[model samples]
Target: MSLTKIVPSKPIKLYCSIICPWAARTWIALTQANVEFEYIEIDLKNKPEWFLKEVNPGGKVPTLKYGDDYLIESAVTTEFVADLLPEAKLLPSDPFELAQSRLMADRFMEFVFPAFRKGLYQGDVAGLSAELFDGIEKFEPYLINAKPFFGGSDHPALAEILVAPFVSRLYLAIESGLVDSATSTKLATDPKYAYFNTWAKNLIASPGVVGTFDKTTNLEQIKERLAPK
Candidate 1:
């Protein structure tokens, strides 16, 4: 799909942190849309006063400044950018397909991610990993058509953009031994999850997805954050 270049009247700036999945979502959307914008990295641990009071009162990363308007929330930011660049076709034109894409993203956030977080941070890694696998099972059938991405689109769709960051994190966790090996194996080799496994591999390798991903740094940060107190 061809992306339409948007020449903004004012400067566009994105406030983000490399380690933040939410920020990654917006970054991927912007990159996929081929939008030119300034990226400003934020230190989540020690956010500056201006960021807290002015940029985003809630002090969240992935805040977008379009001209003088500030936009918060990753999903909203991603959608806004996609809508702004219609020629990108980041989202499907068909209403049913678009709703399906949104539903898929919603499912990952609601079900898969919480399980991943619990497995990573709360202990019982084995049990939680199983739960995570179960959550993944819910979406495996969606990829049964041999499409490289969700919804059978050759290009990364809205669903892929929203979920790829977390999916990449899951791979990092598996490789780092934070998640159980058995769970990882099931995701990789089991027939039930074969489609999802293939989809994940392609998504991770996509330029927009990998461009914003720093696996080494992200893995180390995850290890640090999940370490025992």
Candidate 2:
């Protein structure tokens, strides 16, 4: 391996918060890509002065600093890292394949991201059925034969990395009883998403998605945030 590929003298610095779904994208991408980065956990409640001033003026987690380059935004950072480390093959190599995969991933974000966050942020069961089912309905037919992951295969794909963080959170909430059993039962029984639910159960049990998740505390924080005024 070339020195540039193998060794980054100054480790790529990642400023992130554990709770952020956006930050989790970069985290999963980095792991699957096998890149070495120095992580600086930023306290979202009380962001460091340096993090606020230098890393991200917008005060968001998932700010990437490689050498002098400061990259922000989860999608840009994940894709950029994938492209940079072609050996890892985290993204598609062929041009046509690349375009199609990117399109699907974009669609996943539209349905998956909003629905997951809606349920999580609300911390109530009232709209949970609609939120969970809508995302699955949109994503299921497209994943008719996902082998062991998104699209098809045993290993996780880009869309999985892009969407799994929030899925992980929803599972956490359900397991902790923060979300009602009705919501979980509705998800499991939704005809539009039977396969999707099957896939979700597998994913929630997977190491990559589940390992990064903190079910108990994360739910506590969300509950606190969503509590009535």
Best by TM-score: 1
Tens digits of per-residue lDDT, candidate 1, 68-141, equal 99999988988888887786789888888888788778877776777767755564466567677678877554
lDDT of 1: 0.80
Candidate 2 lDDT score relative to the true structure: 0.70
Model 1 misplacement above 4 A:
1-6, 121-124, 142-146
Question: Total backbone clashes of model 1?
Answer: 0
Top lDDT: which candidate number?
1
Stretches off by above 4 angstroms in model 2 are 1-10, 189-192
lDDT of 2 at 115: 61
Compared with the true structure, all predictions reach lDDT values of: 0.80, 0.70
Q: Write the per-residue lDDT of candidate 2 for residues 106-140, one digit (tens) a residue.
A: 77667765665566666445566566667767766
**lDDT score of residue 160 within candidate 1:** 79
Write out the backbone clash pairs for model 2: none
